[model samples]
Target: MTGAAQIAISGLDPRDRAAIEQLIQRHAWLIDHGKADRIGELFAEDAVLYGIGPDKIGRAAIAEWGRQRAALTERRSRHLQSNILIEPLSPETARGWVALTLYRHDGPGEGLAMPLLIAEYADHYRKAPDGAWLFAERRLSVLFGAA
Candidate 1:
């Protein structure tokens, strides 16, 4: 973790667990629902977002890429993230890892649907000056996909 990140979550008592949980949940909803703008809001001005198919940089680019991805698939996909671990590396820095499964009906056959294994994500988060947990960097390795 970094100094800024540490300060952001420094006072996170037990009661703040729910808030953190919601933050994570909200992140999923934003992406799964194809709410690009909403998802972009989660990132800081200079935030970096990678993975989720292909490569993207900056919050604005991420939003456009997300929108395009949703459009190209021509099918709605639900992304599930589990077993997320958040570790504080410093007062204002932290890292998170999570397992994700992406499923949709855009297979060869109309009725065909399968899970895309994103495997795991190694994310570095930094607390922005405005006190928001934004992805400083997110590295994703795809385990399996139809690509």
Candidate 2:
């Protein structure tokens, strides 16, 4: 196993770049705000989200997964993203892999169930005719974690 593997964000862009940036931002926004139901708005209805454990298919299942996860923990989490690499797979499609670091903060003395949960997201983007580049699929892989 590789020790300390990290995600890398690089390359060029101006307009297309913005699409990739928005993709990640939306991900952070939905997760951090505890609005897991809103994930359906970000992904295609038929899109799949992997690494969210079993029953991982379609937007509804993924949204349910997020809700279940949120119920299991009491700590408030903040998702820290870095080392993102977004590549234009095509005019209507793009791919990105980014690093995710989640901080679960409890009260002063509460021990964290997930002190550090680091994963990398494999994302596929599709451009809507209305001009929003939304996620087609998001496959998550755990890079480093305590559980």
Candidate 3:
């Protein structure tokens, strides 16, 4: 594991940090809005998603999985991510973690549950040739109140 000192020693430039933050924001928005196909753009071509089920590799496969997940009945959800920490491992590689809270309703008339599903997202990122920060891998770990 990377120590606190290591994280303190490593830093991402403002531009890199901003790009990554934007990438994360867009990811949540796209997923919440049932635009799962667009979520693929935020990932690397060979990205891996250690999602709710088995690990999904490659952007195409990930997108397909997201599409199927989005099709699983009409629902509404709002995702809020906070405490984002990005540690630069190299000029082109970094690791990030963020706390996530999901407010969800089962259907059009269903209301959100009292206790939210609080989770943390651990991400590996790589700078692409196009100067975009893409997720190399993402794993979501729920802290409490599973949905």
Candidate with top TM-score is 3
The list of candidate 2 runs beyond 4 A from truth reads 1-13, 66-73, 105-114
User: What is the Cα-based TM-score of model 3?
Assistant: 0.87
Candidate 2, residue 1: how far the Cα is off, in Å: 40
Error of 1 at 71 (Å): 3.8
lDDT of 3: 0.85
RMSD of 3: 3.5
Candidate 3 lDDT, tens digit per residue, 100-126? 988877767868555478889999999
Over the stretch 7-120, how does candidate 1's per-residue lDDT look in tens digits?
A: 456644433334444556677786667564466666666667666666667888777766775565555667788888777665455677878787766544555456855567
**Candidates' TM-scores?**
0.72, 0.75, 0.87
Report the C-alpha lDDT of model 2 over 7-104, residue by residue, as the tens digit: 11333246767866877888787766766656677777677888866646777777777677556445466788888888765566777888888777
Top-scoring candidate (lDDT): 3
Instruction: Name the regions of candidate 1 deviating beyond 4 angstroms.
Output: 1-21, 70-73, 107-110
Write out the backbone clash pairs for model 1: 1-89, 1-90, 1-93, 2-92, 2-93, 3-92, 4-92, 5-92, 6-91, 6-92
**Candidate 3 lDDT for residue 46:** 94
Give the 10-residue window scoring lowest on summed lDDT in candidate 3: 1-10
Q: Report the Cα lDDT for residue 133, model 3.
A: 96
C-alpha lDDT (0 to 100) for residue 22 of candidate 1: 57
